[model samples]
Target: MSAETNKALVRRFFEEVLNGRNLEVIDELVATDYQEHDPFPGQREGREGLKDRMTMLIEGLAPTFTIDDLIAEGDRVVIRWTNNATHSGTFLGIPPTGRSCRFAGIDIFRMDDDRLAEHWHVVDQLSMLQQLELLPSS
Candidate 1:
């Protein structure tokens, strides 16, 4: 796909799937036998399965987080921003602290035939833990 086309695909994915909270978009953006290589949760198959996992992630930190600085290159997009939210739910075995926290990260996605084929992403998990009081605030 052209760079602009790829960028549009990503924009739709983020806008409709992620930000819009529309799981159905996954089917349109992913293959039926999509392969997910998310290290945080092992592996999953099918677009619906991926949507389920994403739903968990979003619901776990909803109304407090949004994707920012989403830029695309070729078939990949690099997102740079902070996930700021109040810890009102459990995460990674950490209880709610009601503490607001911010952590920045970059996610690179690879597209295949206009659909999201794979992803390689990294986030500031340590900073999030610290903000949640699970780790030293220093």
Candidate 2:
């Protein structure tokens, strides 16, 4: 796929899968042998692992996730995103605080045959923990 096509696929992932809470699209957009370099706690490897992580996220925080920026080169696409949500369900052993939280992250995706094959992310976990009152504020 072309660079533009790769970027579009990533955009669709954030829009349809993440923001829309539509797990069904995963099979269509992700490669069967998908891998996550920054796997969530307890998450396994492969496309199923990605689904598990997404399910946890959708259940824990009712977020309005947005992509702030996107860039594509070769078979890779990078996305800068923000998520605003209320802690409505347990997450990684942290019970819901009923608090509003906002966090930012950047994710890089590698495309294989026009499908997402690998992912890596750098997220503001400390800021999110602070917002959830799980850690001391700086």
Candidate 3:
């Protein structure tokens, strides 16, 4: 596929699959043997695994987590965004704080055969916890 086509495929993958809360898009956009190098551990393999993860995230952080400044380059897309969410639910051993916080990060994606084959992410994890008052600021 052309680079442009690959870029479009990735866009659809995110919008229809992740943000749209549609797991069927995975079958359309991702290959059967899709692999993801997630920074967070315990995420299962294959598209079903990804769907489960997304469901957990959305349910846990309703109306809070969002993706912005999303852009694509060739087969790779760079996304810069902020997550402004209230700590009303458990996350990474942190209890609810009832405080909303904002943390920003960037992620780079590489597609394989027009499917989301791999991902590398860098997020402000420490900053997020600090903002949520779950950790002391460094």
Candidate 4:
């Protein structure tokens, strides 16, 4: 696929899959053997694991996610995103605080055969925790 197509696929992931809360699209957009370099706690492996992780996130945060930027080059797409949501469900052993939080992250995805094959991401967890009042801000 062309670089533009790859970028579009990534966009659809954030728009239709994440923000839209449509998990069905994962099977079509992700490879069967997808890999996540930064797996969440208790997160399994492969595309199924990816689906599980997303499910947990959606249920826990009920986030309104937004993609701030997207860049694609040679079968890779990088996305900068922000999410705003209330902590209504447990996440990473932290019980619900019912507080609103905003966090940003950057993800790099590798495309294989027109599907997402691998992913690596960095999220502002510390800031999120602080926003939740789980940690003191500096």
Best by TM-score: 4
Pairs of residues at least 3 apart in sequence or in different chains that clash in candidate 2: none
What is the Cα-based TM-score of model 4? 0.97
lDDT of 4 by residue, 90-121 (tens): 87677899999999999999999999999999
Clashing pairs in 1: none
Among all candidates shown, the one with the greatest lDDT: 4
Give per-residue lDDT, candidate 3, residue 109: 71
Could you tally the backbone clashes for each prediction?
A: 0, 0, 0, 0
Q: Taking the tens digit of each residue's C-alpha lDDT, what string does model 3 give over 1-138?
A: 666676577667656755676777777776665566663355677766666666655544432435676677667777766767666665544556777778877867777776776667787878877887778987
Superposed Cα deviation of residue 115, candidate 2 (Å): 0.5
CA displacement after TM-score superposition, residue 102 of candidate 3 (Å) = 1.4
Compose the digit string of candidate 1's lDDT tens values, residues 12-117: 7767776677888888888776666673353256676677667765665552445677777777776665676667665444567777778877777788887888
Order of candidate numbers by lDDT, starting with the best: 4, 2, 1, 3
Output the better candidate (1/4) by lDDT. 4
Residue 36, model 1, lDDT: 63
- Residue 98 shift from truth in candidate 3, angstroms: 3.5
Query: What ranges in model 1 sit over 4 Å off?
Result: 63-68
**Model 3 reaches what TM-score against the true structure?**
0.73
